[model samples]
Structure formats: structure tokens, C-alpha cells
Target: MEKDKIIKYGSLTLVAIFILSTLSLLFLNSNPSVNPNNSVLQGYVIGYAKISSYDKVVKVQNPTKELEKLLEDLSKNGTIVRSFNFENELVIELKDEKDVYRLNKLFNEYNSSIFADAIIDFENLTFFDDSGKQLSIPNQRKKQKITPLFDIAEPFKIKADAIVGEVSSKEPVVYLLSISLLENEKIQIALKPKNITLISYAISLKIPWDSRSYIYDLSSKLNQSNITNKVNLANYLFFNSTPSNTSLSQLASSNIPFISKITKSTISLNNIQTKKDEINNLLSLYNINVIFPDSSIEIENLDTKNINFIEGLVSNYSNLNISIQKENLVEVEFYQESEYGSTKYVLDEDKLKVRFKTALNPNDIKNISVQAEVVGNKIKDYKIQQEQ
Candidate 1:
């Protein structure tokens, strides 16, 4: 009896150990913690190019081989570069006047680009100061004594810093020269009229200050000048601004006016496009097929539980059909049917068509599952014949 009791206890202990081990393995597989580097943000650019007027001409002098090399590197790295005449000065165009501020902020972080002997002739530009003063062409150049700003060691480093916390406010200032120049002569002289004033000065210094105040001041000045509802210096900065926290992938997605309003889907789509192009270039690098159907599929009545499943199916099969029923459960149909005489034949095309009564909210998604069927070309032909 004693020996039997010991043996029974041993057996129970072994069973418990086995069960615990199995549970541990399952938990680890389901809730795997991805490393930060391997996370989806790996290959994204944290900063984006700002849109600017095309009036500025960049000229480079008897370019040293080093300057040429730098230009080549900037171009390859996706920096916007436009040549002005035969001069070696390469004009860096920004998206908006606010972007001029961002460019200045970037300058504080990296000062090497400032030594290029570039002159920003805003002679044709008209702007206002913080005191509602009319800032016109051939305005006096004011030199402000400001602290020096540090340069970022690498682009990724700046991105990492932004992800960790808010950027600092104290930054350097630059000498700003306000002037009015002809738009036509802007390209000829390499000067453009940017809708900005104090903000332009702040940017030239590489300060990270928000342009809202500067923009407001400019608007007040422009309003006095009878410019209504105009996207002048102040309003443009307010509307087309992006947050400093924008990710690299988000920056590369669209040429939208503001970076702050960028969505995850847009970023994901851009990433998908890039990945697809890469796979096409090196087909042997990946095992999965990247081809997707040309037509759009609709899904309806998807709740949290089955939305994941539908997405997985679409991701795996490249085609799917979806529909929502009574706003409750999501009904997912994988196969398409066609009528033939007295019977209907099912097609093996791994495409899904989906229609949704309403748009799915991004936050409501829960668990996802996908079911796939492998069919050959011959199977597709047979199904077509049966339906016919």
C-alpha cells in the first residue's frame, strides 16, 4: 500500500509538470514580446520634407568634390534638391512657411548644412512682425545673439529622441533679413517669397518653437492689408503643421498639408507598397506570394471578434468577401458561386468579396482568423465548366 501510494503521488506530480510546461509554451507563443528594433517602425523616416515655394534658386560655386558628394548623398537620401543655374548652390525647397520653421529647427540640430554660403533672398516677400508691424522688402537685417544648437548624430537618433519625449524649447536664433522680391525673379536670384516673418527668423536659427504665434501675427498684418481667408504666413502655419512626434513611415506616406493628421492606415499602405516593390525586385528573398487582386472587396457587419479573421484571410489569400448582418455578427463568405442549369458550382478562386453596412472602427477589432483553400488552375477550369 505504501509503495502504491508513493507511485500514485509521483504520477500526479509528473502530470502537473507536463501540463504546466505545455501551458507555458502556449502562453509564450501567443503573447510574444517583439523587440523594439523588430517592431513595425524599423524602416520608417521620422522627419518629412516640408513643401516650400519654388522661387528660391540654390547655387553652388566651383563645387569641391566634397560638396558634389554631399549633394549626391542628399539626393539619394530623399532630400529635395533643385539646381539654380550652373551655380553649385543647391536650393532646398520646403513645403510651407511653417516648414521653414521646421527647417530651422533641423538646422539647430545639424549645423553643417548652414555653412554652404547660401543666401535666402525674401526680397519680394511681405510679412508682419509680432507687433503687427508691416515687414516689407529690403527690410533691415537684424542679428540676434542666440545660443548654439546641437546637431543630431544620426536621423534615427532624432526619431528615437522624439519617440521618448517632447523636444526641448530653448534653441538658437539666426539673423533674419526680410525683403520683397518678384516671384519671377525669385528663381533667377534664388529667392522666393515665403509667407512668414518672425517664424522665418526662428527657423533660420534652427529653433524648434511652434509657428502659431508668428503665424497669428502675420495674419493680423495681412488682414490689415485686406487679405481675407488667405493661407498667408500665420494661417498656413496653423493649418499645415505636423507634430514633432510623427514617425518616419508616416512622413513618407503622403504629401498632405499637415503631418499631425496622418493615419496609421496610410502609413501601413505606404509600407506595404515599399515591401511589395522590394519583394518584386528580389522574388527569391521571400516565400510568400505578394500578388493581390485588382478589384476592391467589401465586408459588412464586422464586430471585434471576426474582423481579425477577415483581415487575416484577406492578407493571406489576397481576396475576400465580407458582409455585416443586423450590426451584430460579421458574416464572412470565402467562395463565389455561379448558376449552371439546375445546380450551382463553387469557384476555387481564393478571392473574397466583402460589403459592410457601416465602416469598421479601428479600435473595435478583436480576434482574427482566416480559412484558406488551396486550388490549382485545373480546379478553377473545372469549376467554371460546371457553372456553365
Candidate 2:
């Protein structure tokens, strides 16, 4: 009986140890956030070329959108490794070469329809095989020669931005404000002008920020402008909230000026600040009252459940640097680069490090490029990167 009791106790101890080891392994292996390098298309690009052309390059639709739509029409089989503007054309890199063949077939089908405006110029489109040899598309259609609708002399330009988190919205969220507004007003909040149905609907929205435009972006601009005291931000920043509803619903409903929707022949990626912003912005447009992650409400305290959403929303864009502190704490830093300088913000969610550990993908946080930083949590320090 004594031997049996000792054996049973020892067996239970071993089982407990095994369970702890398994849990540790699972915790270590689980990825919390997206990896930055996952989006970087270094090699394995089968082909690259411009799919369409426009008379006015400035009016050229963002090729990313078109490419995404084209891929969707093909039943969403391909993963877009990378896309950027080269001269007048958009160069696309795909992981699978077979996907290119399927894409060509869909383009051929488009050529036969009235939607021929975006038909693939088969002769110009290039593809490759597994051996990295340029394989001529099989039974390729004759290159369609069509005159551009409008022609204007302007150098083709493009800016690359990174997408963080999953984007499920059908219509991308874009923030466009007049450049004059930034130059003139200390604080400007503008909305995108409604799409013009008469003209081409492929027009891309001109973005105001170099990297991204967050809803809290106004605060960063104000901090950089050195006019915080000059402008009455109290009226804009503080919003009335109900005891039951801890949100600034009245502020969100306030009329914001509609800036003209300016489009350039640029491919803006489906990059957004947060899923919360994307949802709330859509809700506001349709006169929907409810929202999540509203910034206007006062937070009496912080916890993992409450603060994780806040950190995730502000951590969008590319080239962020995250450091793990001594006690397994985390500090996430975001940077935005501009002609004038770079603005950086670092958020240390106080004793709530595990939230970031789960919210951020540890592999992609370090060694990433940060264009600017949001000083402290509110855009305090303004560092000017002098032009070389």
C-alpha cells in the first residue's frame, strides 16, 4: 500500500509537469500579430507588368485595387506578393506562376466585354515558370491597341504603404484632405467627397499622409504645428458621453467638411489604421449610431481587455519597432515620415504587456522600419529628419 501511494503521487506530479510543458510550448509557438516580412516580396515573383494605361497618368486608377478586383474575379486564387508603380505601369509580383495563366484567361474574357477599358494587354504582360524561365502565355490574344481617353504630361509617381491586420471591407477607407488645408489650418478634419458616378469609377482617392492617416492623426498634426494653444481643440477633442454609453457619439456626428476626392494614377494599397476605424467610418457614413473603440470616452482604468484594442488600432502602417522590456513588457513605436520631418509615438501599456504579446506578431516587430514615431502616447516629441 505504501509503494502504491508513492507511485500514484509520483505519476500525478509527472502529469502536472507534462501539462505545464505542453502549455509553455503552445504559448511560445502561438503568433500574436502579423509579421512585417510576410508581406515583403523578396523572391519567387513569377512575372511583373502594367495591366492597363490611362491618357492622364494622374487619373490612372490605383492598380492595387484593380489587381485585387481582377484576382477576386478569378475566384481569389492568388496571393499578391507586392505591387508598385513603375513609370506609367503597375508592376505586380505573384507567388504562383499558375495563377498568372488563370489571370490571363480572365483578362481575355474581359476583352470580349464592354469592360474592355481594363482589358489586359497580352503582348505586354509577362509570366514565368517554376524554372524561372519566361514562359510565353499559351495562345495569347493579340495585343489590343486602344487610344487613351485623356493624355496629359506629368511624371508618374507612387508611394508604397503597408497594410496591418485583416481588411474585410468591400470599399477601402481613404482619408483625403486638400494640401492647402494642411498648409493653412492648424487643425483640419475633412471627409472624402462622394464618388462621381458619371465618370470612371476606378478613380483612387488621394491620401493626405505620407504613410497613413489615423483618426487621431489630427492630434499629431496639431502637435507638430505648434498651434495647440492657438486653436480651441477642447471643443473638438472632448466629447459629451452618456453614463450608459461611454462614447463621443455627438462629436462623430458633427459635420466635417467634404474635401474634393482627388485621384492620381496611383495604386493605393488597402491600408487602414484599424478595423475599428474602418467599421466606425462606414457606420458614420450610413448614419449608424453605434461604434466600438471610440477614443473620446474617458478611461478610468486600463486592463488587457480594454487596452488591447487601443494598441492594435494605432499600430498600423509599416516599419514599426517593438522592444520587449525586462519583465516581458512591450513598447510599440510607430513612425510617419514627411518632407518636413518624422513623427513617432511609443505606447507602453503599463503592466499590460501580455496584451501586446498576443496582439502583435513578435517575429515582425523587431528590425522593422519606423518612418515616424508618436512621442509618448499623444505625439509629444517632434523630431525633424533633415533632408540629405
Best by TM-score: 1
Model 1 per-residue lDDT tens digits across residues 81-101: 443322233344322323334
Q: Model 1, stretches more than 4 Å misplaced?
A: 1-115, 127-249, 256-388
Q: In model 1, state the lDDT of residue 209.
A: 27
Score candidate 2 by TM-score against the native.
Answer: 0.16
Query: CA shift at 272, candidate 1, in angstroms?
Result: 25
Query: 335, model 2: CA deviation in Å?
Result: 22
| lDDT scores in order | 0.25, 0.25
How close is every model to the real structure, measured as TM-score? 0.19, 0.16
- Scored against the true structure, residue 1 in model 2 reaches a CA lDDT of 16
